[model samples]
Target chain A: MGVIHVTDRQGQRHTLECVEGWRVMEIIRDWGLPIEGVCGGACECATCHVFIAKDWVEKLDPATDEEEDQLDTVITHPTSRLSCQIIWTPDLDGLELTLAPANG
Target chain B: MTDNIETDVVIIGAGPVGLFAVFELGLLDIKCHLIDILPKVGGQCAELYPEKPIYDIPGFPMVTGQGLVDNLLAQIEPFHPTFHFNEMVESVEPIGTPEAPLFRVRTAEDGTTFTCKAIIIAAGGGSFQPKKPPMENIEAYEGTGVFYAVRHMQMFRDKRVLIVGGGDSALDWTVNLQPIVKRLTLLHRRDAFRAAPHTVEKMRALVAGGDMDLHLGQVTHLKGKAPVLEGVEIKKDDGSIVSVDCDVVLPFFGLTMKLGPIANWGLNLHENLIPVDTEKFETNVPGVFAIGDINTYPGKLKLILSGFHEGALAAQKVHRYVYPDKKLLFQYTTSSTSLQKKLGVTA
Candidate 1:
């Protein structure tokens, strides 16, 4: 079990009790904070954009190049990342992520 | 700055059906103002499958969804119709005589109000929007990596792209992204595709090509973290569980559309759709015409070709009713070219 800290674009922090190996998008969508995973956690739609916690950024794995290219097209901050690419592990118990409005 | 601009006609919803009205009316030398909630034109055709192929629309043998939009935009450009993008009509009330009742159309954007002699509701079945996945905590990976539609296919290029759903949207994307994305995985909860046979054939070919993987089952379990989509657990029909390391996941399940602001007008709407139709496309209220998906005509087909036919026909009918003094020109055909050309020529 992993307890990830997710913050919406509005700076609202959600204490998500997520299952290990579950994608981060699964956590936010279940809480119902208005993050439309239009693609349902696929890297195609890019509606599930979020910013990772700066402190824990080093601890997280780097995004693949393709995921990076997709991120450029979406309306997001420099720290933005697509949530579907992220998996839940017990390691980063306090991971912060912020919401960004969809590019549509 | 002006609250309203007076025109001979007002078209709500600047989608393909709405723009088609402008193009058709332009041919008749009729001026109209088009309104929609989108920031620009193209509507659903542009939004849904800009890169995907569309076979239903007539002409050119075949064309991409965006290609159809391009052709439509070209046709409507000559008319120089006024467009109020990102604006929606709150309500359309009729005012004046039977020959030409001036319409009081309220718009929320810019707070500008429009009053036209006639209103043509060329809004399609509705504006299409990406549907959200039902999974909890799905939004947590917002920027990280989650998607609905393929707004940017190149981004997933040279990477593992995992897609869910056995429908047309899913299969079509799988076929398109096969060459771009390094590896593609097609997951369907069913044994067969609901899409036409031709598309399924294309997908099967791709799977056989070895560039794509076909996982026939449900994603019963998901495994991931802050930076990597290391693996996913798929629940197979045979009770076997498979885990995959995916770089990206694209779900093309389906689309959800809204009835625009017309839903709030309170005009005896049937399920927020199905407005009462009197003749052709006229709604329960006079001077207020509902065309395309927004209207429940006796036997209206929801196809773009059909919607365009209904909308164009409704516009012409309204034109005659609005301007009794004007003479009707051109012998328009009510039967679809597909029907007429096929049934008449073939039969």
Candidate 2:
């Protein structure tokens, strides 16, 4: 199990807990945070874009090719990552990230 | 029965983008009637990914695709947008001239018609058609013994039914029809299912209880006469052919999106998407606005939030065509009393 802190676009923090093998997007969405994940978890729509907290960026699994391709079309930053690409693991507990701007 | 209706604007495709279009157009005092091939609203969000969370809708940080659709529906409820469900908009004809035009939209399933001042093509990637399994005689048996979609559950009562596919539809029908059908069998290439985990677990319980049979194989052949399917031949993983006796075959291979009747609407198309100007999102044809994923423009993004923006901009332009004499002054929802009154939040 792991705990994740998600900072939404409104600067509100949502803390959620989940067992391993859950997608970070699923965790945030289940908690009723702001993420559209329009293509579900297909890594197609970039609505699940999230900015990883600097400290936890290196600890998560690297994004796959498809996830990177989808991120290329959206606004990106140094810590940007698609939440669907990050599956939860106990080793990476205490993960923190911020939801990105949708289409502002 | 033929029903003739008149509206200020007729929005096609009742997805998130189309639902939001009603709100934007409603703000301009323009009434709308929405049509979708799906039986219900919330196209992809409701159909493909109802449970998936969407991160990028401006105000709320995260809402499920279906949740956003629900909120959009509630937001547009005050406007009272009319909805025509389970009907495909088959033809769009310019009854009036190029400059001051009126549109006559006709549906395929029922001969219902809508005459409108403007048309908003909010169809996301157009109509959805189910992908059929690779069986040579499948088409011949369609509507007789083989079916793609179940329109009526009573038609399947007490019959030996064979359902193919591993998606939500297959599992859903398996659970729903278990009590009605005389015997039911679910066949897939593997034991894995793409349905909800709880649903998958429930189906497994039913299978273990001998309530239904779960087979692992592909339907390689259909055994039936012309227009009358009798059974199917399955090729098991071990390379042996097993024949399952059944009166009906329902293949739920999922759906494919296509640019159906809108392709013949005389609008200029860039590839498969309707090309539109970024300002008003008007198609090459005047008085016809194409928003959502069905439209393409410079720096066009297919996200639902982007479509909402396009709907807002297009509504501004639609106001001109809908009410040419009135001058449209933009009003913010936060301060405009008239807007708040329309939203029923004026207290």
Q: Highest DockQ: give the candidate number.
A: 2
Q: Mind giving the per-residue lDDT tens digits that candidate 2 earns over A9-100?
A: 78988789876898889988888887877556787666788999999888977877656655543435567799888888887688889998
lDDT of 1 by residue, A1-104 (tens): 66777776576777888878878888778877777665456465566778776787777788876466455334234466888888878887778777765433
TM-score of chain A of 1: 0.87
Worst 10 residues of 2 chain B by lDDT: B128-137
Error of 1 at B186 (Å): 25
DockQ of 2: 0.03
Tens-digit lDDT track of model 2 for B1-347: 68899999999999999999999999999999999988899998887678878888898888998898899999899999999998899999999876777989999998799999999999896787775655766789888888888989999999999998777888899999888999999987665677799999999999999999998777778997878778988887677889999999988866656688888888899878999999999988899999989888888888888899999999998898889899999899999999999999997
lDDT of 1 by residue, B1-347 (tens): 65668887888877778888886666555788988777778776676557767677877678886888788888677678998887777777667775556778888757788878778776665655555544434565444456776877888888888888766777788888888987889887556676678888999987787868998666654457744555567777676889877877676655555666777654667755656454557666556677666677566566778767776666676777557688966643354453333223333
Residue A10 lDDT, candidate 2, scale 0-100: 86
